[model samples]
Target chain A: GEEVAQTPKHLVRGEGQKAKLYCAPIKGHSYVFWYQQVLKNEFKFLISFQNENVFDETGMPKERFSAKCLPNSPCSLEIQATKLEDSAVYFCASSQSTSGGHNEQFFGPGTRLTVL
Target chain B: AQSVSQHNHHVILSEAASLELGCNYSYGGTVNLFWYVQYPGQHLQLLLKYFSGDPLVKGIKGFEAEFIKSKFSFNLRKPSVQWSDTAEYFCAVRAISSGSARQLTFGSGTQLTVLP
Candidate 1:
């Protein structure tokens, strides 16, 4: 695909339920990133992957949030024990690996998750 | 930690009005700057970026931004804005040093409403 793709444009989960989001990077892109947009304005980086390997997980909440990118599958971000504060729009982005990491990241039509 | 600031929370302008949006980042090292626009009910699209070389970069839809290292600012400008140009604008920055993840740090977006 020429553009990054995200699944389940909208997801609704009750409190304590698990919610999962999927993202497929551009066909030739090697890096995938996930960001959470809260309050419709603030974007917080959650994690990133280099191919199928995790490149960075600094922003991820270790206890309840987990992500994976496996070969031949779309990347997944899972949130266990969903809370009202966890409601947000999850955006997926992909970029080609560059020497200096200055490449432009192509974003997907974010998945809006609503936790009640 | 790198942080970005978008001073204008909301801006209203008449059609064909010249526009300027201010963005500043707090980082001392080499950085890559970018501006992204999100039209209503649409996904985010890259407006322009500043990696290296010239500080002035032009993006789609007659938008341009200038990176000022001295002021730690990347201000977006348009000679004339149309009603269709109404959107939310975000400024993002990524540190260009080794060992830094390729995740972008974005600012709180600015809502630009152009009245025709």
Candidate 2:
């Protein structure tokens, strides 16, 4: 069964509008990651969180892109002022530590955003 | 910065044919390699992974990948592929020494279309 869940399978936003994406991590998973796939191919890392704290955000565009994972709430990725280039598929994934030392991340079905 | 490369941008094959996809990475340190598959309209799923020990690792759906340390390559292989296997394949690498341990660098994905 798919553990991770993403809302709004499809979104349409105009340029300069705010676009928000949501993701719910798998139960018991401690890590969350966000990625952007543009042109239906290349995947670019956006950000990652360990629990409610951010672990790494080097890939994020600090200007307009911001993401947050808060307790008792679904993780969210927001683009302040969307541009035509922001139209892409957003994927969320979750992972938890295990005895094997390597825990594989499981992904959500992704949200497709179309900025016009 | 570490990066991954998938040689084939797109691959088309008839059912029952053998399959191979090349993946190379540029990181001069211990790495964790992974092969992920995304079936049409489905979330990304782990096909196989390699951390250490054996150079060859087997995964679900008759998929296998061999990691060659000297060449910095991890190529996916299958003796026979089915039409249901049509999907996008991604190669990802995580450098163990990269301080930000959980960040994954993904390659431009290879889309595999298995014809019936």
For model 1, how does the per-residue alpha-carbon lDDT over A1-116 read when each residue is reduced to its tens digit?
99999999999999999999999999988899999999788799999999999998999998999999999999999999999999999999999876656688999999999998
True contacts kept of 2: 0.56
Worst 10 residues of 2 chain B by lDDT: B95-104
Instruction: Please list the residue runs of candidate 2 whose C-alpha ends up more than 4 Å from where it truly belongs after superposition.
Output: A98-101, B98-101
Screening candidate 1 with a backbone cut-off below 3 angstroms (N, C-alpha, C), the clashing residue pairs are: none
Off by over 4 Å in 1: B99-101
For each candidate in turn, give its C-alpha RMSD to the true structure in angstroms: 1.1, 1.7
Clashing pairs in 2: none
- For A1-116, candidate 2 gives per-residue lDDT tens digits of 24899988999999999999999999988889999999778679899998999998988999999999999999999999999999999999898855555767788999999999
Q: Interface Cα RMSD per model, in Å?
A: 1.9, 2.8
TM-score for the A-chain in each candidate structure: 0.97, 0.95
Instruction: Report the Cα lDDT for residue B12, model 1.
Output: 100
